[model samples]
Target chain A: MQFTSERRLDGAVREREFALGEIPGILWTPGSVSAPAPLILLGPPPLGLRKTYPRLVARARHSAAAGFATATIELPGRGDRPRWPAAEQALAELRRAMEAGEPVSDEIVDALILPLVDRAVPEWQAALDALLSLREIGGPVGYSGGVISIGTRLAVVEPRISAAVLFAGSFVPRAMFQEARQVTIPLHVLLQWDDEGNDRQAALDLFDAFGSKEKTLHANMGGHTGVPQFAGDAAAQFFTRHLK
Target chain B: MQFTSERRLDGAVREREFALGEIPGILWTPGSVSAPAPLILLGPPPLGLRKTYPRLVARARHSAAAGFATATIELPGRGDRPRWPAAEQALAELRRAMEAGEPVSDEIVDALILPLVDRAVPEWQAALDALLSLREIGGPVGYSGGVISIGTRLAVVEPRISAAVLFAGSFVPRAMFQEARQVTIPLHVLLQWDDEGNDRQAALDLFDAFGSKEKTLHANMGGHTGVPQFAGDAAAQFFTRHLK
Candidate 1:
């Protein structure tokens, strides 16, 4: 893993760009890491790790100011990664189906979701490995968004993720729901009530399925992008309470 | 609402075929309806309403033999209904994306699923309306098969359905998971542990998310189509207890 162009930011926080294989990311840390600070692995929406996710940057800064290290990586097919032309074509085809009000087949649904899940999980594991290895970060790790399935996979397969704040911006593959039962970590999931493209019922169901005895759902009435800034603050508080 | 080609079977079960608008279905009732018998509305999987779903036929037969009238309707894309060309195109696109390891956007995911949910729910409600309208069938209704989202919707919106047997053979849209919390009816969910196309975790999660206090999950070790014949018998027994 290599981190370059380190820059000092306001509040004595440090920032750097990182890359480990195809996984590109950014890391943030408090000015004085005299001791190991709690760490958070941030996941992004489908937009991946771009400036488009301002909330991510703000959340990371908040964590740093609160004395924790945070990091987020570009999911495959986003950022500097190569886009799968076939997947793009699939998206186009799906759009046509939607326009024409078509009934999708099971094979199609599997094709759209499974490959992404398979590629993302291992990359997340590697990213987590790289983040935790940083001397400035400590145990009691937390994970926040990308697509929910990545978090779901991390929660199930990565025992190190002690807590998670899942964003209900994506669909839950049916298989992942079953995997969710294995995730007994503390969780804070957020949902926007009127997200146009979102399946509101599925979000509620995923929250209900959480195996975490301490899971809480923070639902706000808004569109997909309408999550208020306060929700992020609340998530920060949650991290402070648990990760700290 | 028209019925044609009525037939009587060896077990004193009476069968009838019907067509209403674009929906086509079959109804089965016990030989004698001395009293109001509980009714079950079986939903077809992607395989549609064919001999392919022998389990469905068997379940309906079991229900009929047990003195309950049972029925099943073809999903919009299956059986006598014409396949939605747009939906098929979407499937092909999804296949390409999977083969090329492409990332699917949330909008594409929604397109792939929402249309089906929209089309299937109304058809299910219609089927319920038609079946209950039949003098041979009476109170205490049940639902089984197809993708789980249909069952989730029926459980929430259709107050007359007293119970449901959901098969974990399909994906759970994230929105449907939220709607699941509204379901308060008795439920008997079935799952095959090694369903190839299924994300096993998602099925378990959907089950855990169900809000019903009177719900049971019958999980067996098998493939997607490997639900043991006895599991159907168990589901029949569950219907007997709940629907009867």
Candidate 2:
């Protein structure tokens, strides 16, 4: 599965310069699309796991096969080769924009690094807005993030999206959860039992908090990277349930 | 987080003479009883991760805190300390019981390999049954197991349990999913993005089949052991949702 990137300009979809909020990113989209369909906004892990995107791409292909337009965005912070300065700068810009009451330019913020920051509310909001824009293409809209990205997405975007999926994410600060009174959409969380960083109870508490009447929680039986199969299926189901 | 094994059944609960169909396991209860209680049913990995149950007890203590009861069972095939013949013999007995369509005796199984297998399923079930039988128990039941034990539990007992959690488990054969039809309770599945053993999609598809309207899918950031923080939250939320 290969990802080809493009942009929508003047009501016409065209190839646009791929920039992850001023930081560089490898924008990936399906090479072929038959129609205007739902879009998937993929937020990859910000660590050095570029080879990992193939799995994400595989999931995107599944989404495309199911009749949705899909895209996997390599955030500025994480990919085969990451530019740390760009990511740090983006974070600073986000903080300044939020503090100065200015409209943040998502294209200028690093999507991958957004998760690593301890306080990423503004960055999270910017990422959410970018995802929402993609949703305007008219099918279903979905986002998948690793750890910090997933946590921020769940904290900021879960309520707005049709369906959201998180892989190995922890509870946002207790304050973020307290701030989120309820989540109305279907949310799915996947975690490992032996995960040393984000233990099982933390995941369950977040699920309990954001899980709507339609949420579901699944615990697979492996170590950190044991459940690629389930993650793919979750992406498909989330898209199918909402976008289809 | 202290785990002390006892050959003498002085502090044990529900201790009884060996009977038919029982599996050997440890019975761990919290020292204090006033706080929210937690019970961990430890099922270790099939191979390569030695001394699985002891590790689980240590990990669970960190999350379950002091008020919880944790039990680790020995798998039928592995974990025989002092190299007891009972471990292998118990498997033979289990196979016979399965072939004969007889109810497995929990007590007999427990006595035979209590010191041998730690984190096996049959042993886990015996421990769970024992915990539930207690009058002082008013908390949640959490489970952790290896690939085989996890699939076995999902195929055999997931529906019967109120809350179930798994780590890096493989797909429960399609035949089993077809046979089971649905899982009504809350399930937490945690897996890595690049797990080699199981087909991630197949497992998620199975969960999709059984998962309740409320479910969660989390993709951890690390390859094998990404985010450890989520584990604790997942346990707490799962127990709270199912136990309370």
Candidate 3:
């Protein structure tokens, strides 16, 4: 990881803006940690992380103040990372199938999600490795933000991540639900009850498929962005219970 | 409706093939109706009422045996009707937006549903007008088959349709849920739980938003065409309870 800038925030938080190879990101930690602190990793939004994502920054600060280090790395096609040309082509084909009133095949669904996940998950794993390597950060990792499949994959593959806060406002490939049935980590899932763009029954199905003995689905009514502010507080509590 | 051909089918059903203006279709009535019988209008499948859709024919025959005259008009772009040339172009634009990972705004959703609904709903209304005018068919109209919003729109505007059996295995505009709230007819909705191309949650949300005093959702597991044989029996029962 290459640190390009360093700063102090809210008087007692240390903020560093850096890049893990090509993945750009920000990390925030409590200014002074006598011992290593627990860590949280925030994933990219559908639009990817931008200055407009005050939510990520605030969550980072929330984690930092709660005595944990927090970090987020840009996913490809997001922030400074240029998009893969294939995503556009794949999406175009999927939408065309939809418009022609054709049933989107499993291959098309795979094209829509797998490539983006494959591109982003490795960067996330690498970023997690780099973030936890820092002297002030310790074990017990939490992952928040979604594309729920990403969290499911990470929970299954990354032993370091102890808990996850999954946003269910995105589509899950049918095969991924089978993968989700293997996710046994403590999980806190958020669902916008009235998300127009999301497949609601699929979200419920994914949640139902989760193998986690300790998993909770927090659902609130509204559109895609209708998650209430208090929902974040509940997520924080969930992370504190599991990660802390 | 102008009758162009007549035949006796499966022993006791009278099959009258007809056209409402430029639209051509088939109607089946139980051979001996002492009085005017209730009518059920089957909406065209996405592929249209072709030989592959033996399901439509079976359902019509089922409704006919249940004592309701059954009819299905050719939706535009199906059978005798030519497809709108702009459907391909609109689909291309939609595909472009999706490829770019753009949020489908209300305008885009409207673009996807309104035109299809606009083209199909009027023809359905016209067909309903013509079908009910026949001496063998009258009163309490039932509409079955869908992308579903077609049924919602018809239920809201077409008073002749006193009940509807909506197939929820299709996309719904976010605004249509509100329109669904205006649907006061008795409804029996069917959903294929594992529909690949559908937003399952949208189907549930639409079902939740229906204002009908008697609305039943029959959700079965499997792919888009996976509605079980029993579902047809239940729907036949629903139409009997309401239309008869």
lDDT of each: 0.76, 0.50, 0.79
Q: Among these predicted structures, which one has the highest TM-score? A: 3
Span of 10 residues, lowest total lDDT, candidate 3 chain B: B213-222
Between candidates 2 and 3, the DockQ winner: 2
TM-scores of the models, in the given order? 0.49, 0.40, 0.50
Scoring each candidate complex against the real one, what DockQ results? Answer: 0.01, 0.08, 0.01
User: What proportion of the true contacts does each candidate reproduce?
Assistant: 0.00, 0.14, 0.00
Q: How many steric overlaps are in each model, in order?
A: 29, 109, 2
For every model in order, what is the iRMS? 13.7, 10.6, 10.9
lDDT of 3 at B71: 84
lDDT of 3 by residue, A113-174 (tens): 88888777888888888888888889889999768888889999888889999998776788
Point out the worst 10-residue segment of candidate 3 chain A by lDDT. A213-222
Evaluated at residue A63, the lDDT of candidate 2 is 58
Predicted candidate 2 versus true structure: per-residue lDDT over B103-179, tens digit per residue: 55664345433433233444555555656666655445655445533543443564335555656443343344553
- For every candidate in turn, the CA RMSD to the true structure comes to 18.3, 19.9, 18.7
lDDT of 1 by residue, B89-196 (tens): 766776676677775444555556678888988887877787777776789888877778888988899888888888887766778789988889977777775676
Candidate 1 chain B weakest ten by summed lDDT: B103-112
